[model samples]
Target: MTNLSPSDKALVPFVSVDHMMQLVHSIGVEPILIGLADYIEADFKRWELFDKTPRIASHSSEGVIELMPTSDGEVYGFKYVNGHPKNTKEGLQTVTAFGLLADVANGYPVLLSEMTLLTALRTAATSALVAKYLAPKGSTTMAMIGNGAQSEFQSLAMKAIVGIDTVRLYDTDRAATRKAARNLAGMGLKVVECDSAEASMEGAQIITTCTADKQYATILTDNMIGSGVHINAIGGDCPGKTELAPAILERSDIFVEFPPQTRVEGEIQQMAEDHPVTELWQVMSGTAKGRTSADQITLFDSVGFAIEDFSALRYVRDHIKGTKFYHDLDLLADPDDPRDLFGMLKRATPA
Candidate 1:
């Protein structure tokens, strides 16, 4: 037996929660959000080059755990995420995730990262990116329903990417609304805490719903929504979980990330299986229409896609270079000889 050292291929860069926060603050949150949106938009432009599929989900009575994976012929990425709405009641996160990226050529991991914060950022960026295309021109105010862990990220992303200057917030829990308002106070946007969901929509051009219930519930009614407003519904992400009223879906021209997945997990699930929806990638690539008239209702039915997560992973991988925000983890078992893994383990043991 001899002493040996692992080579570069054995080391993978890892970004922890603390490192992720430092990276965001180092570049500024809004700028990070914008960068993420740019990466997502670029991927959508080349949407045909990547392998796409619905996230594999496991559902229990409490919530869901999902595996979202994708590859672009060269690199592969996947995220392990769980959504347990009841976790918040136990002083835990409603959602938490981690992800990995690998080189397709050799099947070696290049990066590993904590994705709970990244997911929030990417979700917000995706919403704002879609709004840039479908929202009515000159839209400045957004009605934000469900002021929970994701509220501030969504508001800041809209302000940074979509030019929204005002965010009117509402929540079933008044304390949550207050917390969001407090966090968003100095971020260059006018934060309004509303007593009711309807009050939050007053004079708002964009409405974003992001509640965290596992059951079917209507967070918005048909009469409550008027014309010319863009609805960014991101809360309903599983079967039997929805936010907007069926009448609202009937009245709006809906845009979605992936139709097969959205039809199973988004607001469109309430409608018929053949309900028409414009794939957002087609709109981004100029193959489909976005907002045709000022009076038209445009809805972005976002259910969080694997490609968007892949984009976020790519953004982090690119930005973390030459920075101390990541640590090299010896995640792979490498031996001098490819077939000597057992020998390497034996060498690692004390003689």
Candidate 2:
């Protein structure tokens, strides 16, 4: 094990962006996405075992920064991420991130990784994983409302995890829709571009809203959402940002990751403080109902919880086992004498 190698035992394995992309291509993006979904599902099945809490966020006029942390007794993980929707106009990505995994016993980070791509991967995987529990049977098409950075990943993830074979892409920016359509063309999924958001949902069984706006915008009104469909509401992930009309939230059975967190950041932020919602982990664990009737609507109000990031970190820590997809970063100080901290520093000065 690189983590146990004698000379490199103090080094932490770091997966860079190039390494991450290489690893994705090596394992295939679809399979890795599926793997991430499986890991997330497994973690959800044992939700009670994790020490869960809301992610801490620092909001700004143009963006937000967040630290998501979680632990499952044996290991701990955390991610540092930011969301800046206006950055797109400034020729920057809307989101960027990095994550770390540590041994809870020693509190030493075992793996550090570039999670910008992994966040996109895990978000899509989580959406598809929830759909497996809530979506209509034999779901094949998805209406992707926002065709920005996450659109293609969401399309491919649904195809790999939830049997989605077609995606209808819509965005206010035609270039984004075209880009999403172009990206998915070679991913074995049929992509259709639509002029309006309503047109995108015409025949789709699953509808995903992933706009990056940081304000209250009704991407889907009550009249637009039909029954027997699963809605993945991802963009309404902050206090003032919401995608669905309040009436749609009222009619749908909502599932969320953490109530305290989602109540502040998800679509439920539009509802009452006492509004009831099912936890997705409970639904996955069979302790709560996901979808009971054929004509009922189900909503997975996703706010990018910490447990999902933890699961992604866990999966990457394991999958890079025998591969050359990571670098051992000399991040920790290893002294010959455990108590000789000053001596260790002095030894490296001139010798």
Residue 291 in model 1: lDDT = 96
What is the alpha-carbon lDDT of model 1 when measured against the actual structure?
A: 0.95
lDDT of 1 by residue, 1-351 (tens): 464767889999999999999999999999999999999999999999999999999988888899999999999999999999999889999999999999999999999999999999999999999999988888899999999999999999999999999999999999999999999989899999999999999999999999999889999999999999999999999998999999999999999999999999999999999999999999999999999999899999999999999999999999999999999998888888889889898888876
Per-model TM values vs. the true structure:
0.99, 0.97
Instruction: Give stretches of model 2 more than 4 Å off.
Output: 1-7
Clashes of 2: 0
Task: Write the residue-wise lDDT of candidate 2 on 47-102 in tens digits.
Answer: 99999988888988988999999999999999999989899888998899999999
Per-model CA lDDT versus the true structure: 0.95, 0.92
Error in Å for residue 48 of model 2: 0.4
